[model samples]
Target: MDIQVVHRPGNSAAKLTLDAGESVTAEAGAMIAMSADVGITTTTHKRGSGSLTKTVKRWFAGESLFLNHFESRRAGSEVWLGTPLPGDMTSMTLQRESLIVQGGSFVACESGVEVGVGWQGFRTLLSGESLFWVKLQGTGKVLLNSFGAIYEQPVDGELIVDTGHIVAFNETLQFTLTKAGGSWLHSILGGEGLVCKFRGKGTVWCQSNNQRSFGTALTPTLRARSR
Candidate 1:
């Protein structure tokens, strides 16, 4: 399987070229186009599985309740996928590695990869986003989309990142949610909110823009709907 990301950094899409018998699983409604011969199956969990518990957890994480499995019947078959936001997409290969992805950032992954949910305890609830994270493991290629341009940050020790900007991080790193300023009052008054402090050595992927901040900025301009 070959994955190519096109229109990078803005309005990005992924074009996947698959050989015969190759399959990929993606979030529901992620498929934009695919070859006629490509077979598609929708399920509550990964292909050939009936795990309703996982599906419900994913829904709470802001992901689709179902997953779509695409299989190529013929060589050189192709499939295109896009995200709802206008931003960038990236592909990563996991060699028996584990990744903790921010909810809603997942796009697709090869069949060999396993997708599950990770509970980050009650602290994540204060991040102003979902408390659950999408966890990926196994050896395969994974695709992720972000609300803005994505960049990789190599953390040798510790790094502080706004919670809303993180796309994903290596499982080797431990993160804790904390106030951005020295005190809670300062954090609230300064408008910095909460931030995720990543510790240990690993890589952290972050989006250039924060969707929460963007939405907040637009709130004042958008007239409230009449009830």
Candidate 2:
């Protein structure tokens, strides 16, 4: 399947054109204009003013409905929407047949699909295993965005990632938040405090800039605020 990102970065509307039967998932309300024959479906959820209208238009045009809100379909493949890069959607995991989201909600392709919080809900229906899973249902390409440049680090054993710069990670890695440096006094005085310590074998994706601290440091009176 072929894919093209039509809109440039920072534009109000980012449009993706997919070949027939190719599918892509995106945040709930990002639809601008999709081809009628392309097939679009999502999990069930509440709709704001123009959401339903635009979705219906795409649906009637020949897009097949999958699970609502959480999943979608076109002809040959499916799309799983990632959290909005610039917005407040949280991280998620998909395991086996279930979709698991942390601090957010999910909709299924089939109607009346059970939706709930915590990891147990997904385990009960999909499998008994206690792991996070994110499934890319289709063969088509998908476009993802980030607030800044993303860097990949190959870890053979352990690595520490700054929480603010974390983009995503493989489910195989275990992590915990802890104080950086050797001692509390050092962390406080040196200005680098908490960090995420990751263990096990996997990859860590980090962004070039910290979304929170950078904004604060960028403002005027930066020297006074750093204290």
Candidate 3:
């Protein structure tokens, strides 16, 4: 399958074009447009679009967990899509031809195959691995956007990452959120309360700009309304 990210950084929308007969499945509400022959399906989720015809197998909103899949049959098929969640969903995992994304932040894998997880799940995935277990497959790229200036340290013994700034870390490192600074008073006053601590050795990807706390064109209106 051939794919390309037509839009650069800072754009409101990113386009993914697939070669003829190539198909890909992603979460629902992520598709912008597709060819007429393209097939759209949802799993136990509510879907609606004025531009495209939709069919529901089993529909649920808040309680029912749903995932969407789309496939195209003709070459030069294009889909304009973006993340449906807000900026809080900072991490995502793509594995086994499927993607698991958090509730905040927009995410897309231009091309590749891999699994991804957020700060919580990433710590769980790394709890058992030794320092040497961190691995990066053939040209697999994981994109993570944060809320503040992200910090990183090589995992030799322990590393700390801010809750809002953490993007993604290798599964080989064990992580937990602990109070930074000396005491509770210091932590609160210093403006550095809880930090994601990593123990073991692995690579951590962080963002220079905090995408979670900030706003983007893709940011949800509901979240903006809350603030």
Candidate 4:
């Protein structure tokens, strides 16, 4: 199977070329296009009670609990995948490197990768953010989508990022979500908002824009009709 991310830097998508019998599992609703020989199957993995609970958590986190599998019925079958948001697309080749991604960052992944929920604590809850994130482990290429241009921040000691700007990070890093200032009033007024304090040597990916801020900006115009 061959996967390529094209039209990069903005408005990008993944074009996958699959050999006969090859298949890939993608986040539901990610398929934008495909060739005639490509076949699709949807599964919720409802075989176990444990997975059902996990599925519930994922649903609360703003993600579809089911995965769509695309297979090539004939040689050189092609399929295209994209995110709902307009932004940059990138792929990572993982070999046992666990990845924890913000909600809605995932697009697609090849076989051998396991997707699940990870790392939701009190700090995260206090920030009024989603309680869970998508976690990827095992070995395979995983596609990540961002709300805007994505930047890779290498952290050796400490790094702080606006909570809404985070995309994905490696398991090697430890992070805590907290208010940006010493006092609640200052935190609320300073425009610093919630921030994630990260430590240890690893990498963190952040988006140039914040989704909450974007939504907040639109709320006024959207609600004008109501007034």
Kindly list the per-residue Cα lDDT of model 2 for residues 89-197, writing each as its tens digit.
Answer: 2222333233222111121222222222222233222211112222222122323334455466776788987655665555567666666789979975776666668
Tens digit per residue, CA lDDT, model 3, 35-78 = 67777665532222211111121121111134454566777777
lDDT of 1: 0.92
- The count of residue-pair clashes in candidate 2 stands at 21
Model 3 ranges off by over 4 Å: 44-64, 84-157, 209-227
Please give the distance, in angstroms, between residue 139's alpha carbon in candidate 3 and its true position after superposition.
12
* Per-model TM-score versus the true fold: 0.97, 0.51, 0.56, 0.92
| Candidate 4 lDDT tens digits, 1-227 | 68898877678889988878878888899999999768888876422223776777777767888878888888888989987887888888889889998888888777778778875876777676667898888898889999888889999999998888888999999987777889979998997778899999999998888777888888968746554
lDDT of residue 164 for candidate 3: 50
Report per-prediction Cα RMSD to one decimal: 1.0, 11.3, 9.6, 2.3
Report the alpha-carbon TM-score of model 3 versus the true structure.
Answer: 0.56
Residue 189 in model 1: shift from native, Å?
1.6
Kindly indicate the candidate among 2 and 4 with the higher lDDT: 4
Which runs of model 2 end up more than 4 angstroms from their true locations? 1-22, 36-143, 218-227
How many angstroms is residue 138 displaced in model 1 relative to the true structure, after the best TM-score fit? Answer: 0.4
TM-score: which candidate is best?
A: 1
Against the reference, the lDDT scores of all candidates come to 0.92, 0.41, 0.44, 0.83
lDDT of 4 at 10: 77
